[model samples]
Target chain A: MIEQFFPNVNWDTMFEATYETVYMTAISVAITAVLGILLGLLLFLTSKGNIWENRGVYAITSVLVNIFRSIPFIILIVLLIPFTRFLLDTIRGANAALPALIIGAAPFYARMVEIALREIDKGVIEAARSMGASMTTIIFKVLLAESKPALVSGITVTAIALVGYTAMAGVIGAGGLGNLAFLDGFQRSRDDVTLAATIIILLIVFVIQFIGDFFTNRLDKR
Target chain B: MITISNAKKLFKTKNGSLTAVDDVSLTIKEGEIFGVIGYSGAGKSTLIRMLNGLELPTSGTVDVNGKVISGISSGELRKARQKISMIFQHFNLLWSRTVRENISFPLEIAGVRKNTREKKVEELIKLVGLDGRGDAYPSQLSGGQKQRVGIARALANDPEVLLCDEATSALDPQTTDSILELLVDINKRLGLTIVLITHEMHVIRKICHRVAVMEEGRVVELGNVLDIFKQPKEPITKRFVQQVTEPEETKETIEHLLNDYEDGLVVKLAFVGESAEQPLITTLIRSFNINVNILQGKISHTQNGAYGTLFLHLRGDVPEVKQAVEYLEKASVGVEVITND
Candidate 1:
């Protein structure tokens, strides 16, 4: 019954496509989370009278984040295509789309990360400083640790957002569930394929969300 | 010793430049609990921060352990900060780190090894009487417990000087007492030079050996606790004393009190040091044989010792009362004639 579709069900092709989707989302989320959190921390600390207080630095970073965040994902893909191609060699494939995914998600992730970091108790930072902690020590030990729960939650936001961006990336030549649905289900009149793709994407979202919530709950004791 | 000489801190505000600390010069001796008493924003905090270079002096210098802290660079300033541990009014323990981790933070910064840090942290926990709360997070602790962790953290590096900026202001009265008691105990045991900033005179009275009263970014009165409490020169200091003890019979109170003048004299006698506890009233009665009626009295202890004041109305012969007052004066008790009532 399952093999009735295209002679042998194209199991290898489906598996490869799903693997590409997972690889893209995993790599993009990891890179974006780390870089975004770092940028967000620099933004927060620079503004918050830690080590270096540069109003110019803060203004620049703040404007940059907002600008990146405001641009639509599709336009960003097209606009960044030249740069992405320069960086990754092929703008119309899976490997190349990862860079765009990172670019699209970093600013969004950073916004959430900044908000999360800023929400930590000010007293906690003051405590660390008073205890003779250097700027670096305070960042890694106090700021990041205290902001961990929110960071986890921020990562969750970034992941979900990245998933949406990943699906959108399918509009370009990046292969993912959305491309499968669009190319094989919507563009072709295959209702069963569309239903299957929709169900699988939903499952992935639920799994990611559940893992996010669980870690967030565990780390969040405030 | 902590020497702050002509130290100034000016903050640039929207309205204008405001001085938080104004060329403050003071010294906190070794093994003494010195209190910098002030209302909020009175520059006590700024002064304390200047001690370890957390807040740099706009002009002047703070020499701790003979090192000019204000002239040093940021790295050296941080290293200097290790020798002078500061506790906050807010009990600023890191929320993410366990109480043990928070306590060991300074030690960790100073490059103590892990096993050594763990043992030291345990010892500090025991010292602060938080023996079982080593693994608890700041959120899991109460306000008092949090401050205890703060105290432990402050003591992590075994600093020569411990600066407390309104350390008891956020605590309940009972908890404040215990914290004060713990400070006193730490002072005695470690001989740690404690520079405590507080608005509460009672807190100073509890543990401070000497105190400086700050107001509007200036130290108005500076002396030992007993001297400051007994003969507070500044109006702000007097107001603070009045909170704990009744305000002594002022000229106004005396005028109101002296409305009905009697035959005898009303004399205000003050006691300090040995005179404070002496049986002066009994001696007065025995020598002058004057009928004494107590009108008003106030007693307080300072760093030097117990010092106080007593206002009395002598109801016998005027000349006898006068003679009794003179005798009281001769015995080293300060006597002020409030009125001849």
Candidate 2:
């Protein structure tokens, strides 16, 4: 009965698409995590009343984040096609879809990181300053450590968003479940194949969310 | 070893400008426990922050250990802060870290070697009476235990000065006494100059050698703790003094005594230091032909000395009562005639 319903569902192609989806999500999320954390830290330290307050750096980074966050993901993919070609010398597969995914997601994640850092108590920061801690020490030991659980939660949310973005990358012929579900299942009128792909995508999102919550709960000492 | 000369702070709020710390000057000697007491928004917080260079004074200068802390560059101010540490009412401990890690934080920031840091943290844990609870996070500890961690962390660098910003305000009365005892112990052992900012008069009375009473943005009264308790000049200082003496109840009690004993003089007497513990009431009866009846009395200790107040009923001839009152006054006791019935 299963074979009759999913006659067009090639297991080998489905597995390959699954691999591509994970690959694109992993690489892009990894890049976005590092760049986003740095961008977020810059925004935090240079905020108007922080210990390292610098108006110029704060204003510039805030505008940059706002501009990138304003663009729709589909338009962003098309917009970065020329730059993707220039960077990777190709614009055809999972790897080629990465530049746009990272550029689009990192700024979104940076905003999350900023909110996480801001949630730290002002008194805690003053306590560190009173102890003669340097800016570097505060950022690493106090601010980052205190915000760890929140940062993990932020990263989890970002990772889930990146998963969706990678599937959307199918518009550029990126070989993920999105491409398979859109062209092979939907275009071919194989509604059963589309339903199977949808189930798998839902399962991936649940897994990511579950892992994020587990880590957040374990790390939150407060 | 700290001096402030006409220090002031102005904050630019949405409404024009507000003076947080009005022009004020103070000098704190080494090994002295100086207290600043004020209600909220009275500039006590700003005054304490200025000593550690956390808040820069808009004018005047703050000199600590021969260094001008006000208006200094961030790097220089940070270096100065190494010799001065502070604790908070909330404890302000890093919730993610264990007690030992929190204590070692300053040592780590100062770049003390790992082995030395471990040794120092262990010593501090014992010093603050944490002992086997070193591995416990702040969330697991009680309020008193958290403040112990705060004290240990503040003392990690063996700082010359420890500033306490409403350190006991969040504590219960019993816990506050324990913390105050711990502070007094640390003060004596290390001879560290402690500047305590509190709105609680019991805190000032129990540990401070001298106190500055702040109102609005100015120092309304500054004197030795015993003196402030015995002879408070400002209305704010008098209210603070009443916190320790229970003056409101005493006043009612005095009225009750006055009504009951209509033929005697109702007198209120205050004694300072050794005079409070003296057998002066007996001496008044022995030396003069007067029958003295005690109405209300209490004796409490300050870091400087003991202070006491007494309400007395003198039922003797009016001439003998007047002589007894003069005799008590001559002995350097503070005497006030509440009523001459």
Candidate 3:
């Protein structure tokens, strides 16, 4: 009876699709987290009042983030199809969709990172400078360490946003849980499968929220 | 020793050019606990900031032990700063770092090895009397403990000069005393030249060997504490001294006292530096053969020595009143006569 209403609800198919979704989301999220944060830091460092303040670098990064952020995620996926095929020799599956997801999420994540870093205590920077710390030491040792709680909170925000974006990746044959839900449930009229995917996503969100809150509270001195 | 000659610092803010530290020249001798006392916005802090090149002078020279600090390159400036440590009013220790780690930061930046750094941190922890609390984060400590950690951290580089910019202003009076005693002990044991900037005259009296009183970005009175205290020249300096011990009784109070004993004369006397009040008061009555009715008195001991003030209502012949004033003046009592109208 279950198989009849939801033909794709077979345990092997469901687990495999869930595994694929986790794998794709994890890889893209990890990639975006690193590159996005570094880019965000660059934007921050090159802006006014930062250690490496540079107008030209700041203007360039500002424009790039703005341009990328303006483009709709769905449009970005379609627009990258040609480049995706060129890079990976395929535009119809998970591998092709991975780069597009990373590029799209990176800018969003970068913005979040910049906001988080900017929120660090100004007094911390003053203390670091009066200690006669080097510019590099102030950035890596003083700044990054001091902004850890904010960075963790930013990561949680980025990770949850990436999950939503990953669901949209179903458009390009990225066989995650979203693609399974859309293709086998929505398109093929399977209500039970759709309900199951929605429940699973909620569980994922709850886990992310729990871990993020714990780290934030632990690191905060105030 | 530190020598600042014609030192001037001008900052260009949104309001246009503002002279933070005007052409202020002064010398701070080695091993002396020198003080800079001024009201807020008096450039006392700016003058201290210039000494370590934290705020570079717009013109003139700041020579700390023969090296011109204001002209040094950025790298050299960093090295100079390590040699001239500073503690701030807010106790600027890194909140992310533990107390021990904060103390070890300067040593780490100076490239001291890990084991040596650990040993130095341990010594500093003990030196500041924060031995077991070394592992505590800054938030876990009270304001006084936080400043103690600041002192230990500033001493990490073994700097010859320690600049304290309102280090105790944020603390209560009792905490300020303990902190001042700690600085005195550090000065004696480490032979560290301390330049303390404060608005509190009592603070200057308690610990400063030498003091310069600044008003409106100018040093109006400068001398060893006793010289400034016993014979203050400027009105501002007089006003500062008045905060702790008034050298004269108010006219209204003297008038109120004189209503009953209208036959006597009113007089105020200041005693400073090794002038024992007991002997001086006893001698005044004995030598002049006069009755001195003490109206009000406060004896204070400054860093240099004992000093105080006494307001007296003298009942005697006019000739004897003159003798009593002259006698106290000869004893360096800084006598001032008050007549009720």
Candidate 4:
């Protein structure tokens, strides 16, 4: 009865693929959070009227972020094959997929992080400065702390996007749910396997969103 | 003590150079509540910000408690700022921080120990009258409560001088009074010198010992609060004084009273200092043969003394009214006859 409808879905392989997908998403999201925050802080601090306002640094960073963020993810993976091979000696597994996954998603998340930082009240920063808070203190305690909820929600969105990017990375020989679905499901006409993988992917996305919303709501006092 | 000598602040804008503060020089005494009153863009904000080195004067020097705020190095200035704190018009508490945490922020910046910081935060919470709301977030507090937290934060470092930049502007009148009372209490208790800037005359009249009236990047008039209230020299100063001394409808009420009574002479009498406490109205009725009808009156108390204005209708013989006016003049009361044009 369980295997009645076009029985080609292997539970063990499906579980393995799900684990691979989760592993890729988790690692990339962690690294992306750090890199994105640094880039975002740079963009924000060097912009006009901020503490470290510098036109030259801001313009250079802005151009770099824009160039990376504007490229399509699939094209980016193809374009970064040489860099990925040089960095990791191989370009075919979950680890190989990480460089492209982080590079593709971090700038996207960096823009979100910048928007979150901008939402903080300028007066809060001034009040900190009036207390003689050093720049490091302002950045960590005031700017980042005040914008925590926005930053969490921004990273949540970025995390979900990275999950999707991981699947896209799986298309180019990076093993994950996408690789299993394409090679063993679509190629072999096993509709049930593809349906199973889709279900698992949707479940993963829903769980990430639920966790993100919980933390965001808990952090937001305003 | 603070001394601002030949201080000037200039800004380069799209339209060219704008002088935010011109050659403004003032000496504020220790442990005194000094106030700077001005309308928007009158440079009072720039002037006060200069005292704490928040805004650097393009030309001159601001010396606060023996440290030259304008010429100090950034490292020294940061150290100076811990002793010379400022609070803003908007109660700028960090929304994410609780009242205790917000108040604890300055102490943290000053590198206070964790145990000392916690104890100081509790004491400050009590000082600002926020005893039990320490654990509540700023979002949960009212405007008045937020300001209490702001004041607590400013006081956390035991600042020698507290600069209030339109601190009560955003509060309602009742809240403004409560906050002003708190500031006065802090000033008296801690012997902290306060430099506050506001556009409201009521704030100055209530707490300020000395007041400076600013207009167009300069101090138009400066003197004791009571003296300024008694004889406002500039038109701007007079307008500010009138804010508390005269109600908005006084002119229309006088006109209406003039139309209703065609026989009496309506006169405005100003009482200042010790004279306001005397029973001059009772004396006038007993000594003269006239019917006195009180029209409108207001008395404002300053740090130095009480100042008031009273409008009266004297319906009697013209000679008796003339005698009454002379009598008021002899009693050191300011008298002006209100006549129909």
Candidate 5:
């Protein structure tokens, strides 16, 4: 009964593809969250009127983040191929897709993180400083803690975008649901296979959004 | 105790340099509520921020509790800041944290143990009059309650000096009075030196032992709250004193009274300190042969003493009125003849 409506759908391959997509999105999103936050903090701290105001450092970081964020995701993946090969020794598998996926999403997420940090009340940071909080403490306890809801929602948006990037990476031989849809479904004229992969990807996106919204709502005391 | 000697703060903007605080020198004694009163951008905020090194002076020194705040290293400054806490106009409590957690933040920053932090937080919650609401978020609290949380947070590390940067300006009149009372209570109970900056003269009159009036980045007038109210030399200081001393309709009422009673001389009398407590009005009625008609009066109680102004219409023979004026002048009260002009 299950196979009647979708005769061309290979459940085992579909499961493997789904796992690969989830694995890539998960690893890349985790790394992106960390790297993005660090970069964002640097950007925010060095900007005008911030704690560590430095015009030169702020300009350089701002330029770099802007450049990376402006590049098209597919073009970013292609440009990072050589760097990915050097880092991972090959650029074909899910593991190889990570470098490009993170590099593409981190700058985007870094801007989001910077916006989140900016949304925090300046008085809160000043109050923490007046309390003798060190730079590290302000970063972790005040800035990060105060902006937790924003940061969570920001990474959620970034995570969903990363899922799409993973599928695009699959088009370039990084095996995922995208790879199954393109190589086995599209190239082979299997509409059922493409439909199944699309349904699963939508499900993954829905789950990511559900989890993100949950934490965002739970964390936002404001 | 804090001493700001010849302190100056200048900000370099894109257009030019702006002097926020200019060569201001003052000493705040221990266990006293010192207030800096000024309109916005008059450098009062910059002046208070200098106490905790939140804003470093362009030159000169700020000495707080024996530590030179201006000349200290960042590490040393941070260490010194642990003993100098500040609350803000916005009641800047971290919304992510509950009242209890917010109060515990400074203790956490001071590296207190978890058990001690918890105990200190509970004590502060009670101290700020937010006992049952300790678990509530800042957003759940009213403006007054949020400020209480801010005060509790400032008191967490047992700071020797508490700086209030327009702390009660965000609150309503009733809430402002409550917060001011709490500040006075803290100053007396903990013996904490409080340095507060406000545009409201009522705040200074209520809690401050000493008041400094700032105008255009300079300390225009500095004296005891009662003295400043009694004899405000500077124009800005006089304006501030009038805020609490005279109501908006006092001038109109005086003019109206002047027109209504053409035969009497309307005189404005200022009573300060012990003289305010004296029965001068009753004495004038008994000693002088004149019709003493009280027009309007207001008394403001400062931490030092009471300062008030009374308007009276003295009617009778011109010579008798003259005698009454002389008699009133002989007393400690300040006498001024009010004319239609």
Candidate 6:
């Protein structure tokens, strides 16, 4: 009965596809976290009424982030092919899929990070400054530490969005569950393979959401 | 220890330029608790912020211990701020940190060693009366407890001067008193110069050695607390003084007193310092043979001495009442005849 419900579903290929998906999502999310946080901090510090506010830096960065965020993930993958080939020496497979996945998701994540940082109390920053804390100290000890829960939630949202983008990366011969569903299931009219892929993606998203909720609840002091 | 000369801060808003602090020059002596009292938007906050270089003045100089704070390098201003710690009205504590970590922040900023930081934080925890609550976060504590953490953190670097920016306005009456008492104790023990800004005159009366009444970015009146309370020069100052000294709601009580006792002379006598303890009424009745009926009276004490106001209904002839008024005036007691029938 199970074979009847999931016809021609190769278990070994499914496992390889699932591993590729997790690997691509994990690496892309990690890279986006570091780069997006830096970009977000730059945006926040250079915004008007902030301590390190600068109009020129803020305007340029703001426009770049907006331009990147407005591009759809599928088109972003196609558009970043040349840059991906330049960086990775090829524009196929999971490794080549990385640049597009990270670039497509990082700007979106940076906006979320900016919003999270903005939620921190201005008084807390002032208090840190009044204590003679250096700019580095204030950034790490006050701004980042104070807004940890919000930042964690933002990361979770960005990670889930990356899952969708990684699935889209399968369009250009990137090997993941999405590739399995697109090449073998959708093109060959195998509904069982497509159903299995959908189930696995939902499971991954659920796990990410659960972990995000757990940390947010545990870390929130306010 | 601190001097502000012609310090002004002009903020350019969307409408136009708004003067937050204007040509305010004042000196705060060492080991004295000075207060700046003003209503909201009177620039008292901006004035106190300039002392610590948190808000730099537009054109003038702010000198703390002979260091020119305004327009100095950021690093130099930060170093100067370490010697001049500040506590805020909202406490401004790091919500994510425990009480101990919050107090240890400045010590950490100064790069004190781990063991030394622990010992100092322990001592400060006890000093602020937090005791076993050091492991608690700010969200778990009451308003008073959060302010105690603020106080302990401000004292972490053993600052020579403490700037309190509306430190007790957010607290209730009882909490405000406890915090005021703590400030007084800290002032005495460390001889730390505290410059506090508040809209409450009672706060000024409780601990401030000297006060400057600010209005519309200007120090309208400035004097010792005792002198300011006893003889308020400005109209706004008199209203503030009346809040503390005249407890029975000054205007309505006087109206009621005048309504009831319209036959005899209703004299309002103000007493300050030693005059508050004098037996002027007894001497007048004994010597002048006039009957005295006390109407309404309230006496309050400031840091300096006793200050009070009393309404007396003297049933006597015109000449005798005139003589009693003259006697009070000669004795340095302020006499104001409210209603003379």
Candidate 3 Cα misplacement greater than 4 A, ranges:
A1-7, A43-50, A53-60, A70-72, A78-90, B247-265, B338-341
* Top-DockQ structure, candidate number: 5
Two-chain DockQ for each candidate model: 0.61, 0.80, 0.50, 0.83, 0.91, 0.84
Once superposed on the true structure, which residue ranges of model 5 sit more than 4 Å away at CA? none
Show pairs that collide, candidate 2.
Answer: none
Question: Which candidate leads the pack in TM-score?
Answer: 5
Residue B48's lDDT within candidate 6 is 92
Candidate 4's residue-wise lDDT over B95-207, tens digit each? 99889889989998999999999989988888888888989999899999999999999998999999999999999999999999999999999999999999999999999
Query: For residues B111-182, what per-residue lDDT tens digits would candidate 1 score against the true structure?
Result: 999999999999999999997888999899988999999999999898999999899999999999999999
The C-alpha stretches of model 1 lying farther than 4 A from their native spots are: A1-15, B247-269, B284-299, B309-324, B336-341
- Report the lDDT tens digits of candidate 5 across residue range B1-341: 78889999999999999999999999999998999999999999888989988899999899999999999898999999999999999998899999888998888888999998888888888898997998899999999999999999888888999999999998999999999999999989999999999999999999999999999999989988888888899988989988998899988998998888788799999998888889898889998889998878988888998888999989999999999999999997999999997
Worst 10 residues of 1 chain B by lDDT: B243-252
Question: Can you write out model 1's per-residue Cα lDDT over A1-222, one digit (the tens) per residue?
Answer: 666754422567566667777878999999998889888987887784555678999899989988988899989988888898899788776777887789888988888777887887777777677767888898888888888888888888788878778777876879887777678777877776666666767777788999999998998766
Q: How many residue pairs in model 6 have overlapping backbones? A: 0
- Evaluated on the second chain alone, the candidates' TM-scores are 0.90, 0.96, 0.94, 0.97, 0.98, 0.96
Worst 10-residue lDDT window, candidate 4 chain A = A1-10
lDDT of each: 0.83, 0.91, 0.84, 0.93, 0.92, 0.90
What's the chain B TM-score of candidate 3? Answer: 0.94
In CAPRI terms, model 4 is classed as high
Candidates 3 and 6: which is better by DockQ? 6
Instruction: Give lDDT: candidate 4, residue B156.
Output: 89
Per-residue accuracy of model 3 over B146-231 as CA lDDT, tens digit each: 99999998999899899999999999999899999999999999999999999999899999999999977678889988788778
**Model 6 stretches with alpha carbons more than 4 Å out:** A1-4, B339-341
